[model samples]
Target: MLSEMKDHQSLMAALSENVLIVRMLLSVIFLPGASAGCGAITPVLFSTTPNFMEGLSGSCLQIPCSFNSTDPRYDITRPIYGVWLKATTAFNVTPSSVIFNSSKSVNIYQLEMIGNLTEKNCTTLFSDLNTSYTDRYFFRIESGPVRATACADPLQITVKDSPWSPSINISGGDLKEHQSVTITCSALTPCPHSPPELTWNLQQDSHRQTEKNTDGTFTTKIQENITLSDTHDGYIRCSARYPVNGGNKTAETAVTLSVSYAPRNTSASISPSGLVSAGSWVELNCSSRAKPPASFTWFWNSKHGTINVSVGQVYSFNVTEGGEFYCLATNDLGHQTSSVIRVSIKDNQVSGFTVHIILKILGIIMLYSTIILLECWFRFFKKPKMKTQEPTYVNSEMAKES
Candidate 1:
């Protein structure tokens, strides 16, 4: 009986301990709020097609985004909508999605497909994107329980650098005689999808003029009817200035005009065509052909150097003097001159030279008069006297003539 009683007591103690353990396990399992679980955060992403492509006026651009929910329990029957914000605006965010969905908060953000966002894919687009939206756009995504976001690298739509040498097209053909002409500058490089501004300037004049932007790359002509002057060699240039990813960028090109009417070819020659004797007058008439008559100057190789004969272009030098000489002719266009002439005065001054020339002239005149008088006398008298007198008279007349 004692053994039986001891066994029963031990068994009762074991049963009581097992019951306590079971109760503790039940309390742990049924602890309040234990069933709720925290979900992990997952990231959403965005991308642009062509990543980069040229843009035209009134054109469209597309942006795509992919998203997934962290909590399996969260319903994604509809993906969260996304927003497009301008990077440059001071607004906390860009004017509400330049693109987004119209339906449920969880509905797919579709850019209207007409202008901006189109379908549930979170694929957004921009149409007629103007200068107002010239700034960069980024993506922002939001869902029922979770919000995630991703950004695309800034896109720089700008006019590319122009060709090394650019041709200028004038509204009318190249103008002449100080006439006015309209000239438009277009970029050889294609324009970016982004908006750009085109401008013109004359470097020499420091004149800045704006051209009408036809497209991002082309400009409407600016009429510059100038009463051009020599100084008008001023260079005309065009530039396209626009925004870039890192900052701002610019492209430029230029052209120069040879205003039509110019001075004509000119010449200068010596009358005797070579060295003029020393102390003798040397005439150098500098003559040039031009619409407006040109000016002339005489230069002498002097001790002081090539000295301009302040007098004029026709240089007169006494051949008795020694010097090197030349003549220069000029017009509004330019100037040119004759070859150098060397002059040396010889020591001997021949006084009889003039007398000799005078005597020779007088003798010739006397001889001619005598011949005429005799010819007339012979013609009238010799025929009557006889043909025999003719030979003698003819001989005398010939001698006088000689």
Candidate 2:
């Protein structure tokens, strides 16, 4: 009986051991997972490239994100890729997305990897970035399972300030008809990389301009030589342009130019009402109008001569004889001649009659004067001679009587 009892105890112990073994196997198959194990994937480390920078319009922007996985769990089924996108702003209503490749292994997002990535920085640009595209945005890598994420600070395209209105700077105000003029356009821009071009909206007839270098401020001047015409008046415009944030920016200014010169209008006239007499002192006057003082020269009959006069419209001189007298006036522009004037000399009509009358009066006076002289001679010396004669006669009678 003792031997049988011992045998049962042994059998029971063996059965208990077998049941414990089965329970242990079940725990391994269907129990909760361990917090740390061999198949568990470690978090991947990732960093965004070009953390901070700037870029221009219509240019490519690069966003670099490098990732490292310790468990090597990434595959074609699920890629650790990112989405390059744009945030909504005043000009835009929806957020736009540009997908980089679905590969988790690629390190760079070039211009081809995303929608027109035109800027230099990690920004994806559309063909036309309107004013509504100004907002904040960030890129995200896949998370969990493949389970690694890197977020770059919000990215935004900086719109450079457009250039200011262009203005004209001239060296001088006055020019001759076919003379040259120099004009410079002033540029106002805040963009650091690109320069702007200048052009004229409305100008006179065809002209040629020369470009000259200014200081290091990217300023250049142009010179133009042209014949001045009436069409060069009214509003004139100068314009400048440059690129900005996937778009174009332009500026313009309006101005009016007044050109002054000499010999615009010229004229001359005579002072006397009728023709002047030959061998008489007469005045020949000449005058002209111009910006500066106009020069005057007198002419007899297309013959060159000079005249002195005051600084006024009229120039006068003594004319000994007049056939045809004229004057030539000149200024910086050109010269012109005055119309001809005729002059004549006439003989006196009553001159002979006046001389005959004076001769007759003189003859009458001479006859009266001769008669008075004879009377005076008879009264004085004639009387004395008669007295002497009477005495002689008395003496002769006395002698005869004696």
Error of 1 at 292 (Å): 29
- The TM-score between candidate 2 and the true structure equals 0.31
**Sliding window of 10 residues with minimal summed lDDT for model 1:** 33-42
Model 1: per-residue Cα lDDT over 92-201, one tens digit each:
44445444433433222223422223233444455443444444544454556644433323344422232223335655574444656555555432323443445676
Segments of candidate 1 deviating more than 4 angstroms: 1-82, 85-98, 101-125, 131-138, 142-146, 150-236, 239-364, 376-402
**Model 2, position 10: C-alpha lDDT score:** 100
lDDT (tens digit, per residue) of candidate 2 on 286-384: 666554457776555423454332344455655454446566677665666666655433222244567788899898999889999989988887664
* TM-score of structure candidate 1: 0.31
Native-structure RMSD, model 1: 20.8
Off by over 4 Å in 2: 1-166, 169-177, 181-265, 271-289, 295-311, 316-323, 328-402
